[model samples]
Target: MRLQLNSSSHTPLYLQLEAALRERLASGEWRSGQALPPERELAQQLGVSRITLRRALERLEDEGLLIRRQGSGTYVSQRVEQTLTALTGFSQDMAARGLRASSRWLQRGIFRATPEEALAFGLSPTAEVSRLERLRLTEDEPMALELAALPVRYLPDPQAVGDSLYAYLDLHGLRPVRALQRLRAVAALPRVAELLAIRPGDPVLYIERLSYLPDGSVLEFTRSHYRGDRYDFVAELKGGK
Candidate 1:
């Protein structure tokens, strides 16, 4: 594989490396569990500093897209396990792990839906939606700030919804059978930093998840801000295919 760097591009050299490698992965040039060239070799081949190459690889590893072994080498990460199966609620997952989970509800009100909200929940933009904003905790440690909006027509009383949105769905038989989630790394904002008790500019996980019921009805549109230092995406995978 050939890696190119543009010294003139304002983007950092490490980020450039990340982009090149990600492109290779996306194009199927590198398959899962495939070993990457050694840091020194790749650095020399790309005419860049070893430090830059190492930093790039480390970033990918942190993202769970690569696996590094001490004294061995680095390789592309295998896909996460059980990603295609199971739809468990956060509260239930935490409880199953012997951890206590709770939420500090911030806002509970029915508000006019925005265009984005309407599209996400399959409702009219002028329709009302139940908005929920809360800080979540596990073992008394702040983990995530969850902001969710549900169609008010489906849930009449905002006060009735509690910490576990899934519980409310289950009671009404609207539990989601599947969901689509997107995650990105972002800097913590002032208000979110204050709530998570972290400094501004600290790394945070931005997750947007849209869940739907078995009948294909949109149940919830949630955006959660998770502390990068405290939360991780864990997956288990099988190899034999």
Candidate 2:
């Protein structure tokens, strides 16, 4: 990396280093997940002290632009951003990013509703519900594991459901107009980690959604686990007038 730093300028050396490194990152000098040069080598090449280089790298790590592993060198992060303001399906979200979305169906069939599903869909506990479990992928990369349930009245034939559940619901005039969603961070369990190709203890985002139709009937209840390292959820806030 050829970075020019001005020692005579008023800007501190660490900040200057940070800016230069960020520029290189933005310019794609180093691809995502590529390791940075050793700290000592990088400092010598930049003609700056290792302390200054470390400070700059620390800032980048804290900002989620770089990740530092104990035995491994610093590497670019591969995090994708998702805005929380929109209500969209996995297929739509991936399409907006110009990525092909696909799914590997895990399970699909009609089953008796659980107590929680019964309450969410206003159905009796004994009522059958269409359940679908899938591993969702973007550009062939595992992105999320999803489990969704809908009252049998809405989705009677689970086998007919395709990659996008919302699309299927829309075709039947049962698409949800809005939804209530909650998200929390949790460690990945062994099975989930294996499917997502992450370490068992790695953090993952757990999301629960309850979607409702215009007539106020619950459309679907879904639980999803998203790989934390590859996904970042953002929410926009408005200031008081």
Candidate 3:
């Protein structure tokens, strides 16, 4: 096998090894169910410590791309395959792969709208809004905690909402044409930490999104905190030639 390792890059040695192994797997350089090189000797050849090599192996094992056997050694896994696509929702995305999805409705109440909510939904500040909070789960694993606000003037009833808010909007002729979302990393709040079962100072993904209908009316304003460990947001760039 041809091996390439670069130590001068800013990337960590473990990450570099992980990426290299991933590239080899993607390029069919390593066949499925085949054994990879031993850790100690390969570490020496790659000019990385055995700990670094093991960290890379651990990542691959966690990703289900590598299978580690106690006595036999590490081998390429045959059970890792998934088609990734854009415009995928958690429920539909997980269900397509035969994984289950469930949501625990945290709160459904009406309250006086805030100024920000008014601006998002184009409603008067005095307007009341129906609020929805849910802790979304996949295969019983916590994924995200969602807090959504909708103008009661448009959606007067909160019980009318089903599993998916997007589906509910579609049913009410409020199907969103486009959505603008902002993403940032923030320290988890105490409440968020408690709900997500993480430490308060731990990092979490903060996403604020505004969905707009074709009629130019904002359908919903949602801010969600996603578990960083379970999610990897990818963006593809198509360069203009």
- A best-first ranking of the candidates according to their lDDT comes to 2, 1, 3
Worst 10 residues of 2 by lDDT: 61-70
Error of 1 at 180 (Å): 0.6
**Per-residue lDDT over 42-103 for candidate 3, one digit per residue giving the tens place of the 0 to 100 score:** 77776778998899999988665776778889987643222322433456666765767788
| Each prediction's whole-model lDDT (CA) | 0.81, 0.88, 0.77
Q: Which candidate should be chosen as best, given TM-score against the real structure?
A: 2
Considering only N, C-alpha and C atoms within 3 Å, which residue pairs clash in candidate 2?
A: none
Question: Any runs in candidate 3 off by more than 4 Å, and if so which?
Answer: 1-89
lDDT per residue for candidate 1 within 89-180, as digits (tens), equals: 77886776667889999999999988989889778758889999999887665778999998887778989987788898899978788998
Stretches of candidate 1 off by over 4 Å are 1-85, 237-241
TM-score of every model versus the real structure: 0.63, 0.74, 0.65
Tens-digit lDDT track for model 2 on 1-241? 5467888999999999999999888899898768899999989888889999999999998676887878979988766678988888999888887768899999999998889898888787688899999999876668889999988888889999888888898888887888999999999999999988677888899999999889898888999999887788999999999
Residue 77, model 1: lDDT of 58
**Model 2: CA > 4 A from native:** 2-78
Q: Arrange candidates by TM-score, descending.
A: 2, 3, 1
- Once model 3 is optimally superposed onto the true structure by TM-score, how far is the C-alpha of residue 193 displaced, in angstroms? 1.0
